[model samples]
Target: MGRRIGIKDVAAAAGVSATTVSHILNEVEGKRVNPETRQRVLETARELGYAPNGLARGLRLKRSNTIGFVSDQIATTPHAGRIILGAQEEAAKHDLLLLMLNTGGDPELERKEIDLLLQRQVDGVLYASMYHRVVEMPEQLRSVPTVLLDARSNDPGVPSVVPDEVLGGRTAVRELLSHGHRRIGFINNVDDIPATHGRLEGYLRALAEAGLAEDPRLVVTETADAAGGYRAALRLLQAAERPTALFCFADRMAMGVYRAAAELGMSIPADLSVIGFDNQELICDGLYPGLTTVALPHYEMGARAVVQLLALTGAQDQGTGPAAQEMLPCPLVARASVVSPPRL
Candidate 1:
């Protein structure tokens, strides 16, 4: 409806050269502009409603300034909202937009969509997985700067952001141990993912740190679901020397554990102490007395993946070195489920 305000317009209004305005607006690293001048240019640009022409900038810089988010079944994930929200908010801070595509696990569709994104000149791409696991980067994505989300690769050259599974598992066990739980059991997932193996290592590490010998029978692998949790809990609790506490690999499995505990006439944190991972609030909060658990850094993972991608594409410094695999720590979310074990 009106003539667009350009950088030159803001520069003229702010009594500075267009180059100065460009440096301030583009946030070119190592450019020394006075803070007062920067503030004035920003204020003037805001007042004049000046918006850079994305097309002109992209053509000149040979970059779209947009990222491609390619995911498989991310929508079906309960924590997907938080992950997307984190990425979107962080990208906005860098003045970048994400072009999203969900391929529904169709490899052909994924490749085609990625090619379409490349055609649009996206500066980079985030190849996201619904859960933390190992994934091979697609051939089409190799042509562009890419980062994996909640996933890792066999190739160290591929950058990624995932949760520190070992640390997370150790954290959960340490919490239980702090409450005087030495005779503990682990309800693990049978899947051969990083989480499955890393968490098991963490469990063993924490036990050793406490000078407790490993009891091979205490760690049981199940299907990572409520039914599996129920089955695992029954086996552990029915033993001659039942565990005083149990750490579940997932909240859903913890739900089944609750069911088993009830059937066995066990009161949580009284007859048995319980903890879980993933911190799925619906399961954690809905359970009576709540469920103390270790929370996966879903939002942080998304944000960090963008940082890795930005580094890969040379979009931002992010004060980091060469793009490499990064793992964020999972923190403890405390509730009412875990406490000192019952005096046997």
Candidate 2:
């Protein structure tokens, strides 16, 4: 093997001091090295294959330049790729890497995996959840700079990033209203989760804004599945005054609604308009008259989580203010499903 290239070699080759080479190579801030010298040093370092020892450098800087992405059951979900991709791409922008860990919802395993990450002296962590929900702050994470992705903590002191459930819900309903459907039915999720409540509030808020009153009978809570959606749709459609449009809490529920509509001999868009949430591509694209829906910003959530973590770790100068509870808006994905209601 040839002699290992070092800063001295690059300095000699570039006709500059070792200190000048180090400052330029390490990218130390506030240095006033000449641009010509800096460029020549960089070129010489590349030519000589002079690579700095990342471990030694990290030790000197007291940072690993790596971020830990720890998630529970996210690997098994469809949105996992987008979320991971978002964080990974953003981290790469800062010449950082992401060490991912999936705990499979095991609390003990989570503790152990987190310990492993901490052992590496990671700059910070992104504690992500598969879905939008409230999660308790893990005891192991408190000592480190952390940001919650697609989840929130009860402690307002911790920063978190989540989709704006209320706005998403309102966005879905507004799509229906825009198509001139006033007698709209919202098939909401039965579970008492943030999404369940936020969407409902959005539904009401939209109706109120449009000078319409909330019809208690128009809103029904179901199991948030195809079966539950089918059951609810049957009840709503069988009524003497059936809804002209239906807004489902989830795309899965919309599947049931589609079946219910077919049995009742309703032609979608012509006889009824339907919209769903969660924009699961499989469901949205599989349906005959493709389901128009609201999409959770999974990719954006992951990217923003890193942005927040970078700020917390003082790696980036982004306000980094105390405990930001950021909420991103869910955008509408238009497909073949939504249209103006049938003429009376």
List model 1 lDDT by residue over 1-344, tens digit each. Answer: 68888889999999999999999998899999999999999999999999877898899988887999988897788988878877888898998999999999899998789889999999889898889999999988888889999889989988999999999999999999999999999999999899999999999999999999999999999999999999999999999999999999999999999999999999997999999999999999999879999999989988988888877766444544565899999999999999898886
* Candidate topping lDDT: 2
lDDT of 2 by residue, 5-77 (tens): 9999999999989999999998999999999899899889998999998999899888899999999997568
Model-by-model lDDT, in order?
0.92, 0.93
* lDDT comparing candidate 2 with the true structure: 0.93
Report clashes for each candidate as comma-separated counts.
0, 0
Per-model TM-score, in order, reads: 0.84, 0.85
Relative to the true structure, candidate 2 reaches a TM of 0.85
In candidate 1, list every pair of residues with a backbone clash: none
Model 1 residue runs over 4 Å out of place are: 1-53, 315-321
